[model samples]
Target: MTDDQYVAFGLSPTSGKPEMLNSDIVVAYYDKDDGSFHAVDYSVTARSQCDGTYGMCPDERVNGRNDASVIGGERRNGVTSITFSRPYETNDQLDMPISRYSDPITVIAAIGHLNTRKEANYHDDFVTKSNVVLDFTSSEGNSCSTLVGGGQETPRYLPWPANIIPRGTTNFTATIGPTGGERGYSALTRLADSPSWGLAWWINDLLIPEIYVERGQTYYFTVYGGNDHLNSARYHPLYITSSPEGGFRQKTVDEQNREQVFAGVSYSKMGMPEPTAVGDMCEWRHTAMDAWEDSLTFEEYKDTLYKKCDGDLAGSLVWTVETETPDLVYYQCYSHRNFGWKIHVVDSGRKERQEGNNRGSTLLPTPLLASLLLATTRLLR
Candidate 1:
């Protein structure tokens, strides 16, 4: 039974430098007792120089101090397919920081089993050839634009989590959101002030292209998601209630507090998935209900909001922008009212205005300039 189980190299950041200083190395396996797959980081090293012989030193253990997390994965075909993610930067001296270099980096991997004494042995053919050079780049099948949560002067950055699937597939999955760590995708401050925020599914943490819309054209994107920050603590599946004159108010479902009040404040009715329990994660996709409706559960709403797939907290969605024409085009979660991203749409008349400007420029008489240039050349001859 153990021979059928594979120790596969779980998913890593799909787009990035393989530089030891900028990326992470993940190894994953399955556990029969739990009936689930688990993963551990194999990237931390105490030695400044590695001899390329894995498992020979104390620093080579999988669960060292790299602080990596297994977002989510499944056991299929006797192989435990898992996805591993870490930050591109860190302050730890022993941990290797993922560098942002764009050049090619060499990668050497090996497969072996460890004994009860915690020692591993590799046969002669367990290593890669010296001629192999791995190229690390951003996700190719999808477009991505890196974004910060928000800031005042020097904006803070969130590490775009790596995904384990290609774009356009319904099965494309990822687990990226705010977490507690030095490089976690947390915002420095609330992004309520920016009239226009840069947000999108960064293809490989490399690019964020601008999306232009026309005034009267209707437009739509694939998905919108994020976590809620309450008193600096992160919560998922948060709901916000909106009123025409009263603005927005945050709400969540609680069993004990369903009809209870706290400190003279009453909780508004819960939204989708009526009877939502405390700490239950939720998210919203485009649905029949108006964007700011109060009811969390809808008969026709898309409830695929949180950063978890199949009960594991790591997922991503492909966000594609499509517009027919709009007065409003933005991406904001109900939980985060004062923050979200805005689309850049220009007036259709601007194209005609540019044409008129070009016509006016031709009035300068190019023939006269050409004649003057000819005379100057003749004089020189």
Candidate 2:
């Protein structure tokens, strides 16, 4: 799954060109004996360029490498997909460095590949089977009715593995939590959780309108997330997020303009989902939807969008402003892993914006401004 905030594009900062790196894995498990859900496996391709096809570590020195994997999947529409982590299913593993580019790229795909071939190799080749259990709480817990050891209780699926347990008899039902998957939604969740639906990247964690970075300057941005206190939180659900703090906050996307509120990290906790084990992946894919190609400059893209959507300074929607409004002044289209353009705003010394008019003035008067001016003239008369 691609991270919503950063678009993944294969770019080699080292090579300074588009890259078609190979890195992907796909694994599946089938019943060999009773065929009662035996083998469980997730794929892995060492070459996977998750943060947009590229090497996480260009070499060994920059061992800023990370390890990731994916697991737990059932065939649906003939396609297999699931979240990353253990207990439920695992994705492939990616342990790459962060120095490949001056900017760090996080591969936000299916992850946490436990119980794959690695885990299965725990016992001996003659392993009978102690992997799964009926108890949603205790995966290998005793069966409810039979009180037997093998409680091969099938759990429900999820976009990501949700803490759930199984319950009841004969019916084979499971829930999402508390009772340990009593509703048996795992299969559905697993079915629904796909590469397309794969949101391995923390949507809210990714910074919005990813800072149209400054090139050659060498950038460093950290993404932080957590819950109230982070008890079991390696990183909690609602800490300082990497993405835009929702509400009436700054944004680059059109859909976000409707926000009635703005940046308030406190409220984000109560209103948002608790952070899960699955981490955020920040990928960058170069895009030129609003321009000719990667060659398009940030100023050009902004000028173009201003021209296409709001027109030039002549139109009410468009304004050649003295200052930049991150939200109102969009300068990008489509998306790259985490950026659309790199810009450096250089304030010229000679340019003194016309102060005779309100600073908000563009090329035309706003209808509201025009109305106010006319009313003032009549009152003076």
Candidate 3:
């Protein structure tokens, strides 16, 4: 047997108690060519909430489980997962260990790009990823390996990335890492409901990726929600509109007929970046959405929204809205109410609309414009 292999000594065959600990653990993928699981050139992370009672102490010590990381290091994309191999009972215990475990309680739970800096940005698509592995050691020289290989010493728990939603400010910047100097914030995932910032807002909530993010990636902010809900469900209608003759208007091809976007509010509209002092940048993040869940195809849900507009009608002004299932995220579209007729994200709003010589302005009601479309197109016919 391999040195890292697990040998169940006296474990009960039918014991649901598990031969190993239970925590966030993933089995690294091996190429089998050179006996290494090196595939993706990214880092992995595992997170478990602190279970201890309130009131942290100046000398409080804790630790993680070993069944956590069977094998953690470099790997492409992990296929075989070592689950429940980690344990999480220490955090809730009354007495903190005098010799706290090293690292987090969770095994390596996720893998992608390895970056110890910044905060997690959920803007990137993270469908293809791997989990983290926990590294542990036995109390003495004796060691037991389970499905998650084996190590020495006790297991340590890892913390989840902190989620940051920038509001009331134009930008959020800071330092992120074990060294403790967060400098950026990655807009990880969207909330079920829009996060209101009072006067300011996140453009279209059309985050940078909506996928796996790093520790801190200071995302640039612009614009306000005004009356529009940029952070809405994917099923909701959106506008890729522009302002004709300049500002916000309902015209794709403007008077000049240039293929460009309309500019939004002047520079004054943008809020100065949030102060870098303190931990303004997303140094930590808490991911609420599940990584694995059954979902509909992007095309399937898009068809439903198309039927609502009945776009093909000749005399009617038409716009396209693209979206995904669950309707909480993944949405895009175009609106006749825009000047350059660009693909405007509702959440990002005017901030993303800043393009071309055209400026952003209010559009006439859709009903009024629809009437004009019918009249003008019919007359031309």
TM-score of each: 0.27, 0.18, 0.21
| Model 1 score (lDDT) | 0.30
> Ranking by TM-score, best first?
1, 3, 2
lDDT, candidates in the order shown:
0.30, 0.22, 0.22
User: How much is 184 displaced in model 2, in angstroms?
Assistant: 30
- Residue-level lDDT of model 3, residues 156-185, one tens digit each, is 222123322322232422111111011111
Off by over 4 Å in 1: 1-24, 43-64, 117-125, 142-381
Using TM-score as the yardstick, the better of models 1 and 3 is 1
On lDDT, the candidate that comes out on top is 1
Best of the two (1, 2) by TM-score: 1
- What is the C-alpha lDDT profile of model 1 across 1-381, one tens digit per residue? 132122423122333322322224454545555566555555422211111222222223433454556787665443344565666565644355555575544554444332222222211113333333444554456343433333343333343232221112222111223221111112211122221111122212211211234444433222223233231112222211121111012333342234221111234465333211123232222334222123222211113222332232332322232333232244223322222222344453332112231121111235666777799999999
Question: Could you list the CA RMSD of all candidates, in the order they appear?
Answer: 23.6, 24.2, 19.8
Better of 2 and 3 by TM-score: 3
